[model samples]
Target: MGLSLRTSRFRGAVYFGSKNLLPRNLETMKTRKFLGISLSLIIINLAAIMERADENLLPAVYKEVSEAFSAGPSDLGYLTFVRNFVQGLASPVAGILAINYDRPTVLAIGTLCWALSTAAVGASKYFLQVAFWRAVNGFGLAIVIPALQSFIADSYKDGVRGAGFGFLNLVGTVGGIGGGAIATVMAGNDFWGVPGWRCAFIMMATLSCLIGFLVFQFVVDPRRISTDHDTGKISNREKLIDKSNTSSVTVWSESLAAMKSVMKVQTFQFIVLQGLVGSIPWTAIVFFTFWFELIGFDHNGAATLVSLFAAGCALGSFLGGVIADRLSQIYPHSGRIMCAQFSSFMGIPFSLFLLRVIPQNVSSYYIFAVTLFIMGLTISWCATATNGPMFAEVVPANHRTMIYAFDRAFEVSFSSFAAPVVGILSEKIYGYDPKSVDPLLGSTREAFALSRGLLAMMVVPFGLCSLFYTPLYWTFKQDRENARTASIKETEML
Candidate 1:
């Protein structure tokens, strides 16, 4: 017999089976739907993983790129900044798109943007060409964060969402490490008719495009709702429905109103503020490989060290998710905020260790590697597991994407300036203008200067995040309950 379709508006139920679903039949159908959801998770994440690797790929390979483009450290820094600036600028656009259209469509577009632009960068002979392509690449990278994050937030409730997000971060961060290794190994070798680095970009771009196609064809969006005001419970595994009333609202006014309302939340504002500071350290990661090359290590060695940092980042992020998830189970009210505060406070020492500790020679590489790893771990807990859920819990699924979008935009727009600033600091420490580093290039002095500048910038964010996170403990509970109530009412209105 064919499966039947049943839906109820008032009761809020949808069934795609016969009037009576036999226990065995229901079990099999449930199994099949679960499999579909699993496949969707796999494909979307695979596309995301490749996108992350592509983002990491350029920075990892930037050493050779610098040589090829005849660019100085600051010029290379500007390239990184340019891409992120574009990403920041495009974040709102991506959020708006996500809100207006379906997630998969937006994701597909972003995937193609990076793949094509990265390919263009691979083929470019001019610095401007490379810069232009990198900017496009940043636009692609922008949606990967907010879209996927919104999906996670939309799909799961607060109690279980951390683990889902943590896993997402784990895989993505590992992809970052893998991207570095791939770029490093391929930077100098020849491939099927292309230079090694070029081959790296082309191959990744090709694979991502294929994943993009799969996203358009197969990825199923989970349920997005204004929320049920009465029940305060929504199932992650529930089949999605477009609540008709909400769907009929004028998109522009409603979306703007939703955006304005979330921005007014004090906790949301604090989280966005913390994001500006937290994102600065990532600039170090982007520049870390370049610094390694300048310090006398070859390309492969530097990549390996950076990978170590990535691994630490992945491990820490995974642990954060696990810890926070556990906390949610044990302490429903303040677990997430508490974990976030702890992570923020813990970052201070790690930042100091990685930046303040001097590397005298190549033998001292492991010291920096270990410190960087610990630093990576310390840095991830807040963003990966805590932040997404924290913002998401207070917003309805309808506006969840923008919450993340604005947060990203807030942070990226400010953090975009970090590269030039860090470069300037490095210049002062090295005691040379951009053009005159031949003798001191890659010297211990340059490394120290770079590290000191990086360290100097990290102090404020790490210290201040704890301060910002503290207010959440006092405010998050009430805010969350209020949102929960409001989302339901909003859904009914829609």
Candidate 2:
């Protein structure tokens, strides 16, 4: 949830957005204190979940949206493209804002944007308006998400970072699971005679507004704590200000420097590449509801399966972090990469093969649910947990948000284009001439073709991602040690 929220697509609002963290031994933190902090975190997480629910709800109401606007595959592609492209570019900008300004205030603005845009989306009548509001929603997320991730990273030590992040991701997945259920329930039910899809966005808008008020009024950003001021009232500056002795530097210049510093790392380069390659398939998983429908599941059934898959992803994310932490502690240098490599390799069969080749003579719909659950579990192992925290280990604390921003920007840039590409392929290359008709509920063959083609292309990324691990084995150990040394010096200076 902290970072993997965006990477997972549907749930990308923001987590506990922060500045610099006051770190303690999170593992051994007192039980009462932990519970108190957890309560705050839950409230903050609710805002993000509310903000992101509309995007997650899209799949369940896609047909309704499509019909309402007379949308083609390309039009749907445009909607995804607008939001994701803006999100990618906006991530680094959000990081820069977090570094220079107040995080909670920034998050407030973002939350307001999401809430307003969601309401606007519900009120919108045209496809262009829908796309516009969605893009606005994404921009809001870009601001909130980077801040949240940076804060979450700051709260914990490197040793337990994976587990902490895993917990965050698990919570996010739970939110997404809930979103799917909400979408299923709301898609057809009329509220005040309004369409279900519109109702979903309106509800999200209302929720985001309520949550935003709570966040603005009560959310205490950890990064604002400072040692120099009386009662620590003076705001904490970016770590780079102290490190580079450039307190006078402009926020833009500092952001550029941070971006350059993060990009200069060899190990980080490979890590980003691995994420980039792997996310190609991951981003497309949002479309699986259509596939499940193509195979015979009703909208509710498909949404149920999608939720099941999300649950698997949540459980897997937790287990992946626990395993990654254990392995890294035991084996050191190559352990995390090894686990990732295995996960990616194992993921290929379950994710791609199962998605591509439908099971023959399936006894029941439960088979589909069960298979998707297993697929979700295996496919999600490398999605977060180990790698995100690994970024903290290898990079300077000051530059962490920038690195996250860069990864978000880069991955979203590529993934934003995927929607259009898949749409084009479905229409031009392998399109089914007649839209498939479901006896229970009618479906477009074009949509089915789009799903099929997307599934086929997804197989390639899983294979390519497996090979990215080899380069990391050589560079990771040295980089981790150097980062440790740097962290020690930085701590001493503080």
Candidate 3:
């Protein structure tokens, strides 16, 4: 009787233990799934906000500054330069900050800075003050972009990194589209006695601040994801085994070191040069509102057209990412260079045709719009596709932010120098008289002609930039082969 009772108790104990373990197992799985989804959502949201902010601030501010200060194309171009110049100076510093500090905290600070700077722009009574705040806003953006990109690269696996980047680009594009339309509507009509442009800035600032709060509260530091295994309580042998096998810290460090080592790679140097050249044309488009007005569009029309441009960019980014990812399977490192080359080639012809051959008839508006849309699609998508994958391949996941920041710094610094030079060249070489009117055709037509001519010159640099990428492709191929050989050797040894 005693033995039977003991056996029954043992069976009961086993049943209860299994039941308790089931819930705990389920809970662990649930937590992991939740974390994955949460991180993805956060990344998407952050991308959207960043893109939205960019689109919102530039178009509206250009219009407001031009109208208020009676500024010409050169003055407007200088303003664009100021924004990018500050970004150039700030990005590397931001990258260093990202390396040493908690990413979420750094990002939150950036977001707040963006909000306050934008708000200050809206409130500014002087042109210099507006320009100052715009620079401040650019500084904030410089901090945010690299940090967020690094987070995404660290969070996602290599196999799906392309898709992950694509999604991020897509979200950003969507946000940009929304932002453009919002800016257009707000600036097109006065809201509650506030100037339409002021309202736009206010709205952006409020949204930025709100998003910053969300990020600060809910975004977990990726560093925390591996801390449990990094605890000092583990034996040295066990730690060594883990380091050789499943340790995230070791992987992270290796990835970072690989990126830092890129300075030694000649291919990376060429890529950075290419990036700088590409940035020149990109900056022109960002300040395109000023160009548009010079080309005969009013503020409202320019805003609408900019919105269309943003839409094209959104579509292009998504398509480019998908195409680049597919091509990468076969060509590996060379795929991005090919995409960039094709795009650059297409841009030269398209831009030259638009500037040189297109007639100034009323119907030209429709034709130009279509052309701009196609240009927007191809340029934005192709640039993004090339940049995203190339950067990912060249740098380690952890060091991506630092490399990207430095890349942006170089790109922006050169581009900023180009902007003012472009402006001055237009004024001097193209015979642009901001005060003069062509009695027969009108001042607007004369301005448009000058702007078109200046934009045409930009195509030269962009086309020439393709040459830089060719050598980079070969270098990347060699690096990839070396890595593959090493990886195979390790597998065999194991």
Candidate 4:
């Protein structure tokens, strides 16, 4: 009897031990999946935040440079010209690198470049030096963004891609907020009597480099790490063979052909045109923060308002993705079209109200803040929501990165030119006062007012864009139906 009891006890102990170990194994798996998702999100957010930090840093830096060197309105245009021209020029190269190299290495190099460029900006003495460094900064960002976005799209499945992108946008929004908040806080205090604005750049550069190091060390390339069957590993030789067989052309030739193909697609052409039109307001608002301060608010106040704009953009991005995803399940193309149309249509009236109707005396600051938040939400949603998905779907998976890069190149080039033109307009139309002793010393307030007023005029382009979307949607619908029919016919033949 004693032997029987001892044996039974041992058996019970083994059973319980195995049962407990099962949960531990499951928990470990869960933790790993969570970490993987979290890491990807962080990478996406970091890329966006790094680019947007330039926007947040602009106001403070502009203030410092203006005070130090007495930067005029035209000088500000030169700064924009440098930053945007570099970004536009580097986009195609970045796209090529993203497709050819390992994404992690490319991103690491980009992060390092960005960090060094930002640091150089802080250390520079002359205006031309600042412009040159800013161009380098833009070049770094040009590499980072396309690669990061392509990685995310490659990692996610279509069913949940929108939600994943929405989450990524949320993370990016948080990063932007964090960047602005940090700048605001630093600008509020003098660290060891170091200038607050200068400290902002130093801190940003340090953080960027540290994050890059972490990414280089720990962030596994999703192409290598993802276990999804769709993302099968292929040797470089296989990739090259596949490319050769698909187009019988060199990479650049293939890229150019793809561009021609996309342009021939009416939907794609319209979308690109609409994107350019919509982008003007976005670039204007981001760069005009310095003018905001010149108009009325203190540095901190302007920063806070910009932070709110970022928040609104985040919300819009999330909603836009969700709505588009759901609508695609039902109406196919209608949701995205409506989202763009409504946002642009509504933006016009709101902008006009802010510019023309609002009385200037009673805390116009809050009014502008509220208007900007709405404008940001609508504009960002319209900008990113449909275009990303359209680009992803219209182009073949292999060519998506190149097509996106090409689209970016066109949009950025035009906007780069447009930014300087806007600045010039401000100087000519609003800033110059013939009666004033210092005609060259443009009135910042009038400049901002003119900028806002000019932005409101974009309503015309927005309406034109909305009209263009109709034909684009019809063309996309036809193409989709044709593809579906062809797929069905092929399966039937099989």
Candidate 5:
């Protein structure tokens, strides 16, 4: 007899047969897709958006902030560094919590932390206060991101995992674009005597709190309702609940075990190795708005250019994932690595073209716009297309959160240095003077100097990132098969 799972729209009531079993392929089974796209997927996507928006909020208003605090690029860069470094260190907490609790709870807690921090940053009177809150914001993101990634991993099987992550990132980038654009435009005006940038953070915080509540109340953890893919059995559903109810000692112990298990995976090592170098370029790109402003673009003009680039990245990430998904089916061992290398390699030419080849002048607006859009399109594929889905396949289902968390910990911690490096390079080496920069009129000489620093950060890292993906060609297949064998063994044990 076919197993029947009946439920309301959101709160799933999964009914198993007399054997208390489900088909091995949950993707083909009907018990999946309980809430459709409305609740689970959409809410997760919204959560992704909320996180990205919070991330982009501070950097988006860098000019306003610089003037307000009389801070320079290096100081602003330190704020970002503090946030990312703290977030990276705290990321493993997500995995620990996920082991003991449902992902929804973990997400809710994360949202609460970030929402408070974002609001606090807006209210702070001193730069140090803002820096502290930004660090708190990073901690909150550290928790939310891994849960979100692992949730998608469990929701989609190996075959279409790339597309699933891509869709997640695609939606997330919208928030990044929107957050950055809105903040940039708003910084030019004041709302009810409050700075527009401050208002933006307050509004985002309120919305994030609401989204977190909705997620906690409505969205069901896919793990709670579905069987593990390879085993056709519930891996840790009951155990998760029991552990949550048990003492805290058990939770930490499980967390440590998961971390150890995740660290041993060779595929994960290679991916993290590449990500350490790969992420620096992205970190450095946070200066794009500041550079554009210095290059004579007004608020709307800068927002427009950045949004086009972000839109390109959003679409490119989805397309790359789709292409990788197709290629992986044909060449399971090496397709993702090849796609990743191609995507990372594209960054070199594009970075050189945007920062050096094109003249940094108001006359080149259309040219800059087109080039940025395409550069984003080509270079934004690595994470969604390869790293995420690849990480999912190398580890067991329960270890997903830990692997993602650790990856963020390693990659983000290393990449966080890029912001400060870029800032120092521009000011110390390239002769960028924050005091001389005119946010309104723009400064051509300072802009040129900043571009030189940006070029330095972007090109070499892109080259190294592409080279780092090579080792994955050998390790992926072996690791994937081992994971499969481990899953089968897990099924037998259960």
Candidate 6:
């Protein structure tokens, strides 16, 4: 059982039990490393960063976008609404593709879609054109995200899956911060006779295309490489498929079966239910930078505040996963659920403090910074600490992509409404006058109104999200046991 010196250099192939089958050219380079992490993981993580950067590009420059399009809060909200609605509705494409193709190929296709769309959004001459491109952007994300999630699920074992997802999120958040910061700083200036925001999008698209290429060429599919530990041989189930031999009808039927299997899990159902409510607050927070700008903070200041909060969330994601991993070891059945509820409950108090208690003025910048940072650190744990790892536990390995896809489909489709709702409440109920907004000075009254709209969407949802996790404590144990039993039968049959 001991690995020899030759095995160490090709650790990836050895770990997956495919060392002898590796291509002759790649024998000495079976696994590559960067800063102690696997090259495959690094590539995928970089892809995640680019995806997030592309997503945050528009939101960071909402003020400039509004000015360029002669739009209001409602129009801005509608842009986010359209993107998320399409992303949610189209998420199943990822699951379907995963059934018939390698995830790296699926990911490459998605990256191309989004890259093209991002460039189109930058070049668009009309608001409608931008909207169309944004929809395309959403479709791209719908394809990429689920594939990425399932890839990580297969790469990490059950015990460390939370940390895997958290590490991904943490790295992805860096791209988001960079995208938002660059867009915000550049919105006031132009590059080569083009608007700075447009330039930002174009640059991101170029970078994305390169990353997509790297992913397609370098990242191996973990599921395809797995072997039977007891026999020290290939598992019949993990053989690489002959793509030409598979039919469309067969793929569809298999996909449908996976969907049904995932849908039957009570744990998945509860998690999706919580996600529907929990996602609303995040959807509404797209207006955070815009609100800060309206409160008279300049571009740099607004970006700084948002970045601080994002940095906290980034670190907190990793911390939460580590904590939940340790807790799950101790309390197996209920520890993750407890962590999730506590995280969700923290959202309510923080939403109040950030949107209501903090004075809506530039002078209170430090107060808002500290509060937002701490709030983000505490409230960002639910997904990494519980939902993702729990989803993996309660479903068969093959159904992982389907479960995550459906979760996004349900949660985002419903939560997509929050953006427009916030805009409506701000304009209709709180009396925000978009035309009266001074581009340079900013309107305190408008900031206050936007803050009110945010509160309406955030507080009640946080409480409900917390309450929804209660059922998972009861359902998770049974579902997890069933999954394990099924997996054992599957292995025996293979």
Quick one: best lDDT, which candidate?
5
lDDT of 5: 0.89
Q: Is candidate 2 or 3 superior in lDDT? A: 2
TM-score per candidate, chains pooled: 0.87, 0.85, 0.83, 0.81, 0.92, 0.92
- Which portions of model 2 show Cα errors greater than 4 Å? 1-39, 225-249, 359-364, 433-440, 443-448
Question: Which candidate, 1 or 2, would have the higher lDDT against the true structure?
Answer: 1
Top-scoring candidate (TM-score): 5
Q: Estimate every model's Cα lDDT from 0 to 1.
A: 0.75, 0.71, 0.67, 0.65, 0.89, 0.88
Please, what are the lDDT tens digits per residue for candidate 6 over residues 115-162? 999999889889999999999999999999999998888778888988
On residues 1-494, what C-alpha lDDT tens digit does candidate 2 reach at each position?
74575565533323222211223333234543455456556766666566446567666566667667877556677777788889888888877876666566777888888789888988899888999988998898787777667666766777777777777777878878887678766875778889887888787788788877777776655554443334424433545334435454666787787787778877788877877777777666766765565555666777888899888888887788878888888887877787788778766677555655555222446776787788777667674555687777787776677777777888777778777676677778876443454434544454457666686657777788779868988888888788778767866775
Output the lDDT of residue 110, model 5. 97
- lDDT-based ranking, best first? 5, 6, 1, 2, 3, 4
Candidate 3 lDDT tens digits, 1-494: 99999999999999999998987886785687568557746753674555465545655456555665777667877777887898888887666666555677778888888889988987888879878987988888788877777776666655556666767776786777666656755765677887887888888888888888777777765544542332344332233334546655764574455446656556567778887887777666655555555555655666667767767766777777777777877777677678777776677776776667776444467777787778767776544566655665655434567777777788887888666666677677777676664222335555554565457546877787776778875687776555456545633543
Q: Is 1 or 4 the stronger prediction by lDDT?
A: 1
Candidate 1 overall lDDT versus native = 0.75
Which residue pairs clash in candidate 5? Answer: none
Off by over 4 Å in 6: 1-37, 229-240
- Tell me the tens digit of each residue's lDDT in model 1 across 289-374: 87776677877778888888888878888788878988878887778877887887877887776666555467878787878778
Candidate 3: give the clashing pairs: 316-381
Deviation from native of the Cα of residue 251 in model 4, angstroms: 5.4
Candidate 1, superposed: residue stretches over 4 Å from native: 1-21, 192-194, 224-249, 432-441, 490-494
Candidate 5 lDDT tens digits, 344-449: 9999999999999999999999999999999989998898899999999998888899999999999989999999888899999999898788768889999999
Error of 1 at 87 (Å): 1.2
Cα displacement (Å) at residue 55, model 1 = 1.5
